[model samples]
Target: MKPMQSPLQHTQGGTSSGHRAWSALIGPIGLAMAVGVAYFLGARLSLALLTKPDGVAVFWPAAGIASGTLIALGPRARLPVVLGVVAATIVANILGDRNFAAGVVFALCNAGEALLVAGLIQRTFGREFRLESLRSVVG
Candidate 1:
């Protein structure tokens, strides 16, 4: 015989669900560093080709990477993703010879945008989100 899960438990993925254990198992630093390195590489690659006259990429893939990192890792990853995004953004811009102040500002903007998009996805699709509905695409 097996114990029954509550309807809410079956529908929602949160602390009592499987995802939290990964965060606990990996610990905070590991997650941050992994996301940071991935973001940094992604930013660097995009900058190499997409940079405009002002040193800004025409399309910043790092923002998508950060947002996807947060959404996939769930709510627990927001801080690490933010740190990764900001650090990666500033470093990539600096390496490309952008002004320090501009890099700082750009980093903040990139982080903010990723956070906002991730929040919207979390709201629309829940923590364990899926691409199951038109709302996910249209919204």
Candidate 2:
């Protein structure tokens, strides 16, 4: 008689377990990489077009990108989102001709800013937050 397998079990045997694990990892990895790339590009664009003689940007859209990503992903995905923000911020600052120390500091500050914004929004409106109402946006 053939061995009976649970419905939850994969029919592909040993290799399928590894494949499943790898695929699970791929989702987070891909999200991180996409966020990193987006952050880097946004920062670069803002620095190029909006930076002044004092090295401050008139508008920094990267912050919005990071904060929006954090809020969209929620607390469960905070690790990967922050990681991507940190990596991208560091690289963007370095490529923008800042020193290594400055890059690291800027990266930390940017990530912290994103976290703070996301935290405040979550606290105010809960996890299922939507900016559909005026109170949600202003308050």
Best by lDDT: 2
Worst 10 residues of 1 by lDDT: 5-14
Clashing pairs in 1: none
**Candidate 1 regions with alpha-carbon error over 4 angstroms:** 1-26, 51-56, 133-138
Best by TM-score: 2
Whole-model lDDT values for every prediction: 0.75, 0.81
User: Relative to the unseen true structure, what is the C-alpha lDDT of residue 127 in candidate 2, on a scale of 0 to 100?
Assistant: 94
Cα lDDT, model 1, residue 16: 64
What ranges in model 2 sit over 4 Å off? 1-20
